[model samples]
Target: MFLGSYFVLSICYNLYLSFFRNSKYYPDPITHLVAKQSEALVDGFGYNAQILPHHAELSMKLIVNQVYLARIIEGCNAISIMILFASFVLSFFGRLKLSLLYILAGLVLIYAMNIIRIAVLAIGIYKFPQHTVFLHSIIFPLIIYGTVFLLWVAWVRIYAKKQNS
Candidate 1:
């Protein structure tokens, strides 16, 4: 029963995101601003670049080939992180008051991780442009998803145990 409702809500929220909200998935105003600022900073520092349409606002940077690289792949896109966190909570934690608190905390941690991930990737790309694709798609996703997976594991192990106790 919980799973069914969670699935429904998640689907509906995603749908709302796809349509009613900023279609680009900018995450939040802060991330968008940061992405834009980062682009400006890069250009100011003499790196030719432009901001790209991103999965989350302020989350992607487009360079010479129009390659869209995530500005903050670690999960800085707060909305996506929050949605993912909430989905995880709903799916795994069930409907509980504390679950929402956990979701909020998870989002904050995920956002911080994303900031670090993007900084690393940006440096990596500047240092080894040849490996941008590898870093952008494969490595970055693995890191962010892997971190989220760990959070989920911890949440289940700790929170579930506490609830049962």
Candidate 2:
């Protein structure tokens, strides 16, 4: 009973943090900084750069929360998203205190993944302009979702259901 309540509370807390807190969220601060850095890449790295119009679209739609929440609710976000989701799952299965470790680990992993995604997207746009749409719209989302799916499976096999058994 206590564990169930903790799971509910943790979900609520993650939701609140992602939505209501509205301060800073994982990868947001770093994401913003990276965006700035990316702009200078064209000149600095001599790599042709094109603005990712989706950035504006995502911000305009507040997709950050959407992304985070969707991943949490679905128990998938990409490998990193899965990591974050796992923390919540771990909190429930491993007990709440130990879950904090999962959360921290998830944060680190997510940040790294976010950076890789951004870098790949940027390069994809620069090198294969025509394929940018496919990369951004299809491939990236697929990677994220696919990773999430695998993570959930792993969580079930290794942690969540494992604990229950």
Candidate 3:
């Protein structure tokens, strides 16, 4: 039941986002916001970072000092990860209030971490162009997925266990 609902809701939400919420200028609002925040953070650190919208609704190029560092898309925004996280938490739901609170906190942490990850990636790519592929394909993913895994572990240990007891 949980998996079914998760898939259905996720598909519906993605479809809605693709058809209604996105535009040619910007694919996804959340992704655009992420890119903007990332650019701001990178610029704050004294780098000339800019987010240029691409033709696709969900594509934006992150340019650092006029050098293209990364292309951020909807997939990079972390919403899908949050949805997956929330789904798992809901599946193993504990006390209603506590579950809701944990989900909110987890989502916030994930979002913040994602933003930081993007900023770091932009900086890393700019400073070490040769390592761009490694940073994007490996390090950044590990950071996000590792955080999610840790969050899941914490949830199981702290909240889910309480339900069993």
Candidate 4:
């Protein structure tokens, strides 16, 4: 069930991304929104960040202090991660309402974490350009994936409660 649901959700998301490629949404809506929100976070951190829409590449350029730190692409928006997280939660197949609510909460947590990750990554890259590789590839990916892992563990433990009862 998890595999099937993950595949279907991934396919649907990919199709949605494909549809927006030629449309007027500007690299689709969610990616753009994520970029904007991340930019706001960076600004809150007082870095003078700017997010410019690159329609041709279908990405947002995350520029901090006039330095190109990263491109906020669709992959950076965390939808795929949410899909994976949601699939696992649903696979457990507990009470319908409980599962749906948990999925929603998990997605929100992931989204917020992604925004903070981007903000911090941009700052890390800005301040410590030498460690870009370690910061981006190693540290930030762990932040999101690690959250999913912990959430999965917590969900499973909750089910243990039900069984114990």
Write down the lDDT of every candidate, Cα atoms only. Answer: 0.63, 0.47, 0.87, 0.91
Predicted candidate 1 versus true structure: per-residue lDDT over 1-165, tens digit per residue? 445755776686567545534534464445565566556555655566576655444245545225444454223454555566667666676457777777777877776666556655665687688998998888877777887888889888876787688
Clash pairs, candidate 3, are 27-57, 27-58
What is the C-alpha lDDT profile of model 4 across 1-165, one tens digit per residue?
Answer: 899999999999989988888665568888888999999999999989999987568788999999988898889999999999999987887878888888899999999999999999999999999999999889999999999999999999886787678
Considering every candidate listed, which one attains the maximal TM-score?
4
Best by lDDT: 4
lDDT of 3 by residue, 67-152 (tens): 98779987899988888888888888888899899999999999999999999999998899899899999999998999899999
- TM-score, each model? 0.61, 0.51, 0.91, 0.95
Candidate 2, residues 36-153: lDDT per residue as tens digits?
4443443345554332323322221112211211111112123335444654455446555645565555555554555455556555655676786788778766765565555456
Supply the global lDDT for candidate 4: 0.91
Residue-level lDDT for 114 in candidate 4:
94
Better of 1 and 4 by lDDT: 4
Candidate 2 least-lDDT 10 residues = 65-74
Looking at candidate 3, the ten consecutive residues that score lowest on lDDT are 16-25
